[model samples]
Target: MSVRELVVLGSASAVPTRTRNHNGYLLRWDGRGLLFDPGEGTQRQMAHAGVSAHDVDWICVTHFHGDHCLGVPGVVQRIARDGVAHPVDAAFPASGTEYWRRLRHAAVFRDTDVIRERPITGAAARLDTGDAPFTLTARRLSHPVEAYGYRLEEPDGVTMLRGELAARGIQGPLVRRLQQEGRVVAPDGRTVTREECSVPRPGQKVAFVMDTGLCDAVHELAAEVDLLVIESTFLAEDSALASEYGHLTAAQAGRVAADCGVRRLVLTHISERYGAEDEPRFAEQAAAAYSGDIVLVQDLDRVDVPPRRRAR
Candidate 1:
């Protein structure tokens, strides 16, 4: 069975308290896995979340902040330790090439996986992995540094209609031939077009935004996404602090979701000040702003992507 879910490894913003770890998330989309913003202790956190280095197909870093990328060296070393033969593409801000290089060589082990440094330079650029089911798009976000958000879009599929199949008396070999050729002729002297029989199955989309203050780019990155994983580093009461630090409050993240028409909103990168008791208040604040499903993410929590919106 195929699966699409965000396995939250750690959700704390800057410093990790006893209750929370630093920022890290594992996106399991179909057969591929993408690791985003792996902060300290992510290697262990992955094990805690039932995620392995073998499962990671991509490592996407939004910026060079310690809380966003401190775990890269460890993760890279562990991937080598695990002996994963397949390549794992690493995407980050091209401006932070030095930081990524330091992390890439922090500690040396036998390099087994093909780790490619795919950097993002501007507002929008596509990362074509050549074999993955989805294509990645990186968009510039509003942060102090050259931060960017990542989006994944799967290829659209063609769904054939059963009624059209019977109407054309097309079966077995002819049906397969039509699917391959895009058109076929029936024995009854009728021509069947692929468009007449098949409907376009809209592709699934996931967006990841972190370490950015509330901005128009936030809405643009998350527009019409099936799942949006965003940072909510403060409560609504501390929104001022959030803005000063170039971060988002729970309410602000919710408001972006409400405005962008996102199907599911996941609130992460929490401040350590908030306890379990304090989470409800933030949730309530975000809920007030966002009508769609809201998730107050924690360490090891898994949030599933909602089904695609039916075609109008």
Candidate 2:
């Protein structure tokens, strides 16, 4: 019954278009909800997307840019107003501590004091999400500001083969015991091992690379990921502008996905200049490089993280 999907709240880059709102993304992994780069109007967008403040367990800000962190105040206040009982961890660049303080305390409200601050100061860091099945890591990204990208990796596990279990005449309680104990004694006095019936399941990986140009960290983060959600702020024709503004073009995003062996490439943070009619052009440009699934994301789009790869 676990659900893992990325809910796109908003997709605009520097400015909000008539149709597109500012940046906001929610990654729902099992029971944890990670809110990334919440920009202006994130609260309203979350409501529109049927997400509540109580659903957010962590808030990850890429940088202090207005389009990335402006919604912190409203989100924080909303969490307080709703009395979110659990502690919400907020991660951002350590250099932007002052900006975070201003945003967290922009207005006076009944503070629940449930928001915990964990600033990222190093080139790489791991976030401690207690009991979460995945490892969360952050890496520095190539941006004009002190920005970071995040990667989540699930641990490799074993998948029980029902056919193999049936062939061994194992059923009901015996199957559960075998799975829990890794081995179980059958009625015939023969020991059935989990390895005999289960195959290796390679963990699924998801990376979020926002507000960054091409860099070594970008490739490192995207490498071998099942899903890569990255910014495509411009097309190939506007490569110069993208480079100057510390953003990635659709072609560049595609190349990164291909080079890094990403299974699926999700291109978001689209600029307002590209109208609705021009959306397909972005996907076309990206498709030219990456052979995998390419998705040009829009507001409120939900992309599921594909299941783990099973052993052949």
Candidate 3:
């Protein structure tokens, strides 16, 4: 069976607390692993989480913020060290190309051409993930520096009705033909259509919203997604500070989730001020708006993407 889960390597914000390291999340989708916002100490945190550099198929940087991307050099070096044969694609703000170049060669280490640079140029655009299972897109976010949010949308497919297939005496390769071609000829010289035997199954979607204030792009990226991993750098009580720093409050994250019809809201980029005792309050504040699942992520925690919704 395929595995789909978000591994939280580090969940702290600009500053690292005693427990929280920095912002790093590994989203494992089937055979691919997307590493997002590898902040300081992410190399160590990944080791602690039992994640190796070989597992990262893509590196997605929200911005050039130290807390969001300081560990790029280490992760890149490690990828080269491990001699990962697969090409690793990286996406970040086009404006930060210089910063990325510096980070890529931060130290004297063996470099490999396996790392491919894919910088975002427009305000909103589709990313080139190359024959991946899903379509990845990026949208500009409201932040002091150039930042972008990413969303992955899988194409919709049909869910074969087992009862209908059995009634039609379809099995084995015949079933595969029906699924692939949308129609198959039965042994009785009759035609079986996909619509007659299956329901439309909406494919799963996942979005990442990091280090941004409330914005239309935020909701647009998160619209109807199965999982939304967003930044909640402050509580509602500090809304002024949050607005000034271009970061979302827990309540804002919750409101976004509710407005976007998100299935699960995984809140990260938590401010260092909030300790273990205050972590529960993040969920409480988010619950004030969204009724769906909420997760105040902890270091090394793993949040599984919810199962696909029933076909309509």
Candidate 4:
């Protein structure tokens, strides 16, 4: 069976606390694992989360902040050290090429030559991961540095209705023929069409928004997503501080989720200032705006994506 979930490796914002590490998230979708904004100590966090370097198919960096990209060197070296057979794609701001290079080669190690570079330069761009069922798109975010957010969308498909097929006396080979050719002649010589039995299955969408203030791109990337993982760096009382540092407050994150029709809101990258006792306040603040599911992430937490929406 295929798995789709978000594994929180670390969820601290600017600094690491006793309970929270730096910003790191691993999204397991089907057979592909996409690691986002791996911060300091990400390798150790990955080990604790039971994720191996071989499982990573893509590394997406939101910006070159030390708290976000400091672990890139260790992760890259680990990939080479383990000699992962598959190619790992790395995506980040094209303007941060020098920073990416510095981290990628911070230490000398065996060159596995398996890492593929994919830099995002424009206001928006799309990447084609060969053989992957989904398309990845990046949009510029409102941050002090060149930052980008990513979204993944699976292609829409049709779901076969077994009951409809059985009622039409279409079975075995006839079912396969109907699916392949979109039509088949039933045992009664009646023409059966695939559309008559199957219903439209809408594609699933997941978005990752990190270290960005309120902006159009934020709303665009989050619109109508099945799962939205966003940074809620501060509470509503610290809105000034959050705006100054290009981060979103809990209320803002909630508003975005409500406005964008996000089915699930995952609040991560929390500041250490909010101690364990204050965690509930953040969820309460967000709940004031969004009625959907709210998840205040912690280190090593696993959140499964909601099931795909069925056609009515």
Top-scoring candidate (TM-score): 3
Instruction: Please provide, for model 4 over 1-312, each residue's C-alpha lDDT reduced to its tens digit, 9 standing for 90 to 100.
Output: 899999999999889999999988999999999999999999999999999999899999999999899999999999998989999999999999999999999987887788999999899999868998799999999999989999999988788899999999999998888878999999999999999999988899999999999999999999999999999999999999999999999999999999999999999999989888899988899999999999998899999998989875
Among all windows of ten consecutive residues in candidate 2, which has the lowest summed lDDT?
303-312
Ranking by TM-score: 3, 4, 2, 1
| lDDT assessment of candidate 1 | 0.88
In order, candidate lDDTs are 0.88, 0.92, 0.93, 0.94
Lowest lDDT 10-residue stretch of candidate 1? 303-312
TM-score of each: 0.94, 0.95, 0.98, 0.97
After superposition, the stretches of candidate 3 with alpha carbons farther than 4 Å from their true spots are none
lDDT of 2 by residue, 1-312 (tens): 999999999999989998888999999998889999999999999999999999999999999999999999999999999999998999999999999999999998988788999999889999987788898899999899999999999988788899989888789999889988999887777889999999888889999999998999999899999999999999999999999999999999999999999998999999988888988988899989989999888899999987667675
- Residue 272, candidate 1: alpha-carbon lDDT: 82
Candidate 4 residue runs with Cα over 4 Å from true position: none
TM-score of 1: 0.94
lDDT of 1 by residue, 60-106 (tens): 99999999999999999988988887899999999999999999889
TM-score of 3: 0.98
